[model samples]
Target: MCVDSPLPHLDRPFDYQVPAEAAAAAQPGTRVKVRFSGQLIDGFVLERAAGSDHEGKLSFLDKVVSPEPVLTPRVARLAREVADRYAGTLSDVLRLAIPPRHARAEAAPPAEPPPPFTAAVDGLAWHRYVAGAALLRALADGRAPRAVWTALPGEDWPARLAAAAATSLAAGRGALIVVADARDLDRLDAALLRVLGGPGHHVALSAAAGPSERYKRFLAVARGSARIVIGTRAAAFAPVADLGLVAIWDDGDDLHSDQRAPYPHARQVLLARAELEHCAAIVGGFGRTAEAQQLIETGWAIEVGATREELRRSMPRVVTVGEQERARDNAQAAAARLPTLAWRAARDALNAGAPVLIQVPRRGYLPAVACADCFTPARCAVCSGPLALPAAHGVPSCRWCGRPAADHACPQCGRRRLRAAVVGARRTAEELARAFPDTPVRTSGRDGILTSVPGEATLVVSTPGAEPLADGGFGAVLLLDAWAFLTRADLRGTEEALRRWFAAAALARPGAPVVVVADGGLVAVQALLRFDPAWLAARELAERRELGFPPAVRIAALTGPPAAVAELLSLAELPPGAEVLGPVPAAEEGHERMLVRTTRSAGKALALALKTAAGARSVRKAADPVKIQVDPLDLL
Candidate 1:
């Protein structure tokens, strides 16, 4: 049986004897209870045998948890492959694959399908792309074709995905669609229902819904009742029967990265699933990541996107406010965070009876506070924690401990006065409100995001990912605090920054002005102006290749206490050409981090080596635990 044990040493399955009374229910794919270490544990029955292969007496089954075979042969095989690929335990992968079975959900009556969207697929954005038709043909004919799609700004990508899914469903095969987040899922789910004609045709799986709802959807997919599945990262493992296609939208988004053990990304997981299941794969997004580019470069996937002429016509007009222009008006720079050009554009947009979007990088009233006198960061007088304002004009308080800083004074400057080191969404909204007192200003961010802004003239101040769509799209978009995104310590900072900017700008109506306050000469900013994520991605990949960084080379990060991490690395039997960098101090006290780099061909071997080393440590009962992350999004 495949035991539900997360131990590295117990990765493989063990044989167990089925009692005569429970022999009928102990079939393969059924969840069972087994006696391990004198304690009952859960396990999935792989197969039943007439004869024992062991020389010694086998332990009898503790109990049969369920007669339903939730773990299908395909899912079981896929889970095993995923575990091996990530060097993770089977149990962890299975935990992702199969949620806890809810009996009430299993017994629930089948839901009738919703009305199908009978709209024709002609004139869809995907039809404008070169390889789009070919991809659809492959899915329709049950031919496995892989492609990387770059969606144009304001494109109805969900409709395109639904059209592709319809093609698969027309055939005798099923399709699985994985998006980055719940927002995308909601959009795609509604679109898919419209195209495919109902809830009976496809099931939407996401943790955003209640447990019962999620379980019911999962049950439908597992029981082969629903041939199409759409969901967030977790849906990548959906057990749809006769899978024909696996498509992931916005693969560059961090939400696609799994937060659980082994931390498998939705893109990578879908890629592996396609290869293993012999199905078509599509990685579609507005901005291409280095990893997706690598797939195209390696001929693993074909590129599908609009032509340059089409891209130019589809994108909004972009204007850049460079440092030179800002320097030309020092008073404007000192007196206002928004450049004069951006202010003019927003004013013009509002006057034109259209809403304007202001994209900020941070949220809250005062994200960062500093001393007014010496320009040093303000800290809590008692706890020494960083101080911040919880609300507009509110008293300063320590962000860490929530202690009020009413009587606090700056240590370095010895001043009681404080300044806004970093302006946030609320602060930006406050300033914009004051600047345009007659115009209505709305705020959107972590506190509560707006799905759609009220129509007509208003200024919508939002952080990245919180920009709401206007009725007819925003008349203008102002990308503020460009330096904040550009100055992030992560390796993908530039790529991420461009993505955030592009997403907000994409909301603006075509021909409407989009003003960016950043370095115009920078490649990322230039790409935004040109509306070319492919160009930026290609450039980023070239630089990474030259530096021997990730996407060019596979890298894993190991973090733990200095001594334990060092010891683990020392014991690792890495693949040839492996390079180890740093035992640098980590953000957490007493912890350190290191990176192991290797060629793409050697990534599996490297992962296996680390897994084996970790298993050895586990067997030895090591006190310090090391965390290993492969292809981590944040490499700070």
Candidate 2:
């Protein structure tokens, strides 16, 4: 027998009895097994009730999978809110929020002790770091806290994480540090290992760490064996004891999403964790996301950074190169296609015995392939691979599943011999090498090419992973494909382009010529030309406001099977002023997605309606799966 709460109509929690053998170690947060409909199912223990509503009839817990109670009161409470925010379910949120159990890997030996990190954090480092302290305090207080948002220049950002780790360890507390990429984590881990060396102080938590390593680290955090934790998006729910701070670096990056079931984003999990744990949070990035700016405006966070001039001294000089002008002037076209001035500046800098850095907007050999004539996507019939003319192989290979096949004629247009429509790091590298043939052209992107190019006579082609230049400086930097960015249709396309531009520019030597390819007339271009992220953010912020998007309102998306999504949309009981945008058709699977937008005042209610609908018994009985994404970056 299973204990169903009387409020079965609502998506709320119900308690189940613990089996006699498991009761000894059974805790509120532990995972438990229960018999429901004559089948064993997994369930979490919200609490251990003294008695039940049943007249002395109670189903004992089947078993306690682990002694560790993964869910905290903070996590449970926040899970409910998250479910509501994205029109998701507590079960779904839980599934996304908590990492899976690894019995085999859980028993592995702990990693070797890290080297001592005792460098004095002073001056530039100290100032940049102190701002993150607010987050450190919230975590120590033991409340799931809201995520934080802060904007800083690239030059001043590296040491900020070190300061966070120092602050946490200094307080005799533990923490988990997560970044958007492997390189960022490596930098943070190295910096932390140098600043606070101890086996239990800090650990890099990534899927690449292997199951045993991850499990050992996970168990350590759950057991409160480590105080400081560091990893990627998946590490958001890391069970650090006395969880004090949850800091998200560059929340704007798409890499923050889990890309798996429950499909949670780091920012969401951090905020949920903060709210549940009452921990202070800090979301810091070189550029501000409207979402973060919204948090600041709502009095949830404080803004911290240097004055424009102070930042400019540390910031690189940016200039825009017009493609139209280049096309008009054959003289300019002779230099390069990505951006002539930027490319030449990089070459000249390299010739002067300094490394040059380049940033491409999108990744892969062409993530999106379209009909050359009609501009409609040319997908492979066998596997939906975007057809491309590979410089290495004539046959195009599906980027996703890697099925190689001949380019089929565009069924719609009967056009064959598709051309490379999009520019990527590989293409960029090939072009740069041809331009600076004599100079060594090192590249990094999806190829695992590290960005640590020697800062002498080298042209480094990278797609964002190239950071803090291996030597702490690059003589010149190129912000290529500026128009390639302006042409993108995504909401954050411009914002992300600017962020990448700023990040790449930050690698340049002060006063070095940084060239952007977009026309200087464009807003994003002018913003870079002016070296003003604040101004750009303000403009983006205003646009978001006028559009009734997040910062002004909360938005949630439901995508998956069309019928299921439509069903969820139909059942939505939105509060007044909380409007439903669409059961609109999505790009794939004829999938339908319903977007719920709510004003600030009605945000919680809208969230609640979604929660109710998702957890409703009627909807659950329908037995359909719809992916719920809150603050979704990919609307298509």
lDDT of 2: 0.67
**lDDT score at residue 583, model 2, on the 0-100 scale:** 69
Q: Write the per-residue lDDT of candidate 1 for residues 1-636, one digit (tens) a residue.
A: 988877787888898988889988888889999999888999999877788778998999899998878888888888887777777888999898888878898777766543443434443455789988888877767899999998888777888988888788777788999987777888898898787665688888888787888988888887777889999888888888899999998788998898888788888889988998999999998888999998999999999988988888778999999644654353533344677888888889989999999999989988889988898998877777888987766899988899888887877767888889988999888888777878999999998888898669999999999888788889999998898989888899999998898889888888889998888888889999889998899999999999988889888899999888878888789998899998788878899899999998999898899888888888888899898888788766
Relative to the true structure, how large is the alpha-carbon lDDT of every model? 0.85, 0.67
Which residue pairs show collisions in model 1?
A: 114-198, 114-199, 116-197, 117-194
Leading candidate by TM-score: 1
